[model samples]
Target: MKSFLVGIVLGLFAFKCISSLYVKVLKPQSTKTGPERALLVAPGAYIKGEAYEPLGLQIRETCDFQLWVVLLLDFFDNIVNPLQLGEAVNKAIQSLKDEGFTDGSPVFLAGHSLGGTMVAMHGKNHYKDLSGVLLYAAYLTKGNKLSDYPVPVLTLSGDLDGLTRITRIMDTFQELYEDVSSNMKAKYRTPVLVMEGVNHGQFASGKMPSNVAEHDLPPDVTNVTAYQKIARYTCSFISNIASSSALSQQVLDEGFNTTFRLLEPLARVKALETNGFSHWTELAQKYIIELQNKTQISVRGIEENGQMIKFEFLFPKAEVHNSAVAITTYSLVTYPLDPFDVTLNPLSPIQIQAKMLSQERAKHVLPNGRYGAGNITCKDINQLSILEAFQNSSDVARERFSKRGRQIYLDEDQIVESSVQWQATQLRLSDGSDGLHVSSIKYKLPFDPIQESKSGLFYCALLSPFRAMEWIYVDSMRLKS
Candidate 1:
């Protein structure tokens, strides 16, 4: 009898594993059957920055407008090749309209890193009818407004992200939307979401971990566990917004009514620690009760472009503030292109004899500890010089690279000397092992080497050595501007 019970348990485990794998492979197959009610604009993985092949092809097969995922790497591929970003956006937008998905049906735009930023942009400019927006380590372009929001937006990021440092970006988004539309700004609305323990790359389930090189551990952090709970709640909020036309009113009423009606659940917070529930859901249901008790909080107008956009939150301050404990804020702004600069010349790809070279002129002990080349340029300086701006500050450089790297100059040994050429520019890399070899990096704003400044959604694309060259093609080659 014991052996039989053991066999039954093992069989069940096997069934679960097989079922999980089957669902994973067939998940994308959702597009095969008919006109989808929802559309997904997915960001490209590390390889294909803007490869819309899956979505394009999926539309041809399954007419179901159920979901759309747009790959961002290609949509914003200005880092490696600054030509394809605009084209990707245009094509994706056109694809949505062309599919005959006009009104009522919800559209979802989601991307990781650069892809996520594009989703934000798309939702801001187009997709007025979208149900929700989800971003992972994404950046927001300045001047774009997301206020008077027709749909809810969920921006997720790991607290410990070293590369993207998206915390600042989230703050900027919250501030920017405060006054863009008086009607859209939330008086008591919380826009920023902080996911504890999640690294920048863990937005999806089962994908390879971005930090796998250093740590062979499972993905779990106290904060991330908290974040996971929040994610479910946020997704549900967004899904509901997309599902209903009177979403704004309904969400507000439901949220407000629940605040007072569910006080008993909030009172059991301490008991939760002793009783040890089966899942976090039990805890979350209690938290929802806490939200239902607050009658309302009034939020005044928000400042935007030096002007105020008025709106009010009816929930009480204590309830709203408590709700925002996991979230934080930042600031963002935009400046227009200078029209007086008539000498603006578009950067044409140059044929570069790719030889890695670092700054040999180290006359004194540098603060950043390493002597690196000024921005590597093919020929003329243009907007593609953003890589230089994101370099570790001299202080950070000295600790991590200068002293540790042990070489006299920074990035001196890591340079690869080879003949590398863009369409019109020739790239001069640092020729040594210490020199950083960038696989892929995408930013929203055009780099201005001449001005010596960088801005917008900056992303680094990391891939295995085998997939390096494929990165070029997967990142679309079209230029929109």
Candidate 2:
């Protein structure tokens, strides 16, 4: 027992020494001449900054942002001299300036995990001098305001990150996502992206033995693919931030166009990968509750008891605030399904029950359809067609909204809402890791479903703020007698 105890202590001491030594041995990157823009990258606790080389390399391929990898020795430095990390900010800026980067030149700060926290904390004092912030798998601590959000902030996180879960990232910036659309002036004010099938440590290229603490790891997506997507989103955000209004649109168009070109080949591979109908269907059912976009939207089970429709949606995970499943039920005769034409009108618009539910309350959803997790105020609304819900949607959004998403048969004039009373209870996410388990979601109790039109119904997609890269749609659902 004495020997075992000595061995454990010796092992810990050796690890502590070895970690510090690793940071010292890393060589600093040589400066590039006449760099267009500057980006200073920092690493998490106990992580070497060089681990982000692959991501930086990918980012530089598209954007002109010069990468200045900070040699932040967190494991030892954080323990012995934490203030050194903070002091390095001014030094890093001066270093950039010395390397021919001017005061007017676009300069950005980026950090991952704990390093991100430190960079965010720096915002309370020096955010006015910076152009923007790139936080990966991390969120700003409460009470830290970054230039009243004038600094274009992009928080890119992984959906499967266990150390810092995606839900926490959403909750941390719930205020930003929930704010009225008009008030959101700076397009890049807050765009929180959750990459599918990515884990916490995956953000950094080098995999170290230290990553064992990360939980709920991804079952799919290689690190290379994840980094490629990450770099693409990062590049787009940086380029847009640096561009003028007209130029920004061009940048977005190019980025989206690039994604469109890859979809054809990705679709072919996806088809081959998911060969069996049974396998695809099983994945589809699970995705509906998970907020993925699918080809069809099928309710796991739907019951029509009087005016109230109760659904057996599985469940949601634990988060800083709450979780919800957004269901788009479409009543349709349906046209040919096209992958490239998603933004186009799928068919006819579906009408919602006269009363109120999630969609009707919040007329225009955020870009990613995020109306932050909470009770959608249910009010007594007159018979409203799905088209009316998007009354405030932008011209671009309207093009899609006009004929997109919604599908439910039965005429809007045929709803027969006379003497109708409205009642709405927000759909809730139950507690714990039991998200895979089933739960009841009751949101409306007033408008009756057109009984005769039930069979022709084709639900569109189940979107959750916790969305994956792939979309999941329910092809169809059965009517309960």
Candidate 3:
């Protein structure tokens, strides 16, 4: 009986030794194909390349794309030693390049969870070589810089993913979208797809995390169905990038409508929306207009109702003391007159002025766990008059305004055109104790504005508590006479 017990203990030890050796020395295999485009996939931590076999097969069957599953150092090492894992990814990519997957064809980097973060970090360095990046349930550090990466980025996250909240993912997306350079705007547009009712573990099809508490399971769709939809979008994104064409919004929207049942949470949307601007679409439109006006790029034409002439005036970027929680205001004011009168006399001069204001607030938690808040009004104000020009006008005018200390500078006086009552529409948001505010005045002139046709004005102001105040504005108005 003693000999038999000793033998059993020895057998268990031997099995453990062999398993450790297998995990430590295991290397990922390379799959070769003659396809023009190839997808290099990185697996999540503790998950082997075999776990992604089902996803890879789906990609092959549906899109006919080549797949390469990258392996890292063992699971234990990955959590502790990120550098070693990074080296493995680099070696795998280099091998793929040597094996006829040259830069001539598009190479896309894809990953799930930890794999997603690794590919993003790698793609930052190899952005020029890779066509695009796809991240699934990936981890994004707070204040992660997305502007440095120039290539197109596509992020997929589950709405109910507890590990990586959908709010954080969308916030990251907004940061990336805002940081896109003017030169790359035409070719690349970053789009995010949030799968409703899914969770973190479902991104991987075969093996799910044994600890269910860490995941947010979808009540409607099975894991298999979720993976199928993921594969479809992933393939479509890769195809679009390979063609060097802009991603098709129609295709993505259609897939989203068919696969996902819900939009982002209402509470998340409400947090970003200002009073009266209750819908996310309204905020999105405002940002879209601002981008178009700032970049001086207009892809769509304005509707002509044959009666009222309509155009947009864009203000400069505003500096917020609290970027995480701040209100954005966009106001449009138009002259009150007979629509026929302005149409008849197309050469009316417009005047523009800008002002800045500050406000403070205090809040405390009550004994009942409720909250109390109040605002402290400020008496400080600064104003400046901005110059304007019109198209077809030979004598173009330019003026510069500079402020020193608390002294405000006005290069020109306020020109009162016809006593024209203007209609004003504004979108504003206010939060916390301290905030900076700006107000602008604009008027139409007889001469055309000094910019390309269909261009608008953009103004930005910097009001910092620790530094001197700076006012900047960009006027790209080309008024038609």
Q: Identify the candidate with maximal TM-score.
A: 2
The residue-by-residue lDDT of candidate 3 on 98-196, one tens digit each, is 664545667676777767877777777667767888887773444445555567667777654645555446556555435544433422345566665
Q: Candidate 1 has what TM-score?
A: 0.33
What are the lDDT scores of the predictions, listed in order?
0.33, 0.42, 0.41
Q: Provide the lowest-lDDT 10-residue window in model 3.
A: 357-366
lDDT for residue 12 in candidate 2, whole number 0-100 = 89
Q: Is candidate 1 or candidate 3 better by TM-score?
A: 3
How badly does each model clash, as a count of residue pairs? 87, 18, 21
Residue 31 displacement (Å), model 2: 14
lDDT of 1: 0.33
Total clashes in model 1, counting residue pairs 3 or more apart in sequence or in different chains: 87
- TM per candidate comes to 0.33, 0.45, 0.44
Over 4 Å off, model 1: 1-41, 44-104, 128-132, 148-152, 166-170, 173-190, 204-219, 222-234, 244-481
Candidates ranked, most accurate by lDDT first: 2, 3, 1
